[model samples]
Target: MTGARAMLPLGAALALGLWLWAVRDLPWPGWPLDPQAMTLDQIRMGYGMMPRGVVALLAGAALGLAGAILQVVLRNPVADPTTLGISAGAQLALVLATVAAPDLLGPGRWPIAMAGG
Candidate 1:
């Protein structure tokens, strides 16, 4: 097997294990949804933090993919978000949106930022 194909499962398993460990102390030996086993705080924290962490992880992965694709497409190792001015342009658009039309960025700032980029 190719190196990446061989390593992907191992990497995914390691990440999953680390993520499970980082979730929180669960009510083991009892039921997962058993309120009597775990406190409300523990439940809230496990549920809340896991989703946020997943979202952050996904976002970072997406950005990494985008950067890699951009570099490959441009045939330049230095062609990243910042070097391509996408980062600066997006920031400028955010600033402009905040100043000129805050409402445009209220619910969905992605299209606006993308347009600006």
Candidate 2:
């Protein structure tokens, strides 16, 4: 792989580790529906829930990789999750889920939601 390509995973790992470390000590805000309110400690301490910080970091990295792939495939600098309608599709899916099936927003829902996108 090219240097930039080779560094991608390493960078993602570092970023993810940093993110998990940053939130590992924060208290969960007791908002079940809000991802931001969730914390690494809460995930470890209660219900065996996965860490929101890791989830967020992974999601960010995934999106970045997806965008890079799209841009390269399309030969367009502007190609991205937005240009591919992925962002809109994800938003629509979340809106529908929130309105029609709020239960899907619970723990372990992120991967499902992302898959839906």
lDDT of 2 by residue, 16-48 (tens): 798678657656556466545666566564535
Candidate 1 wrong stretches, greater than 4 Å: 1-31, 34-37
lDDT, candidate 1, 83-113, per-residue tens: 7799889889999998999988868889878
TM-score of each: 0.64, 0.41
**Candidate 1 structure lDDT:** 0.80
Model 2 scores worst on lDDT over the 10 consecutive residues at 45-54
Best by lDDT: 1
Find the candidate with the highest TM-score and give its number.
Answer: 1
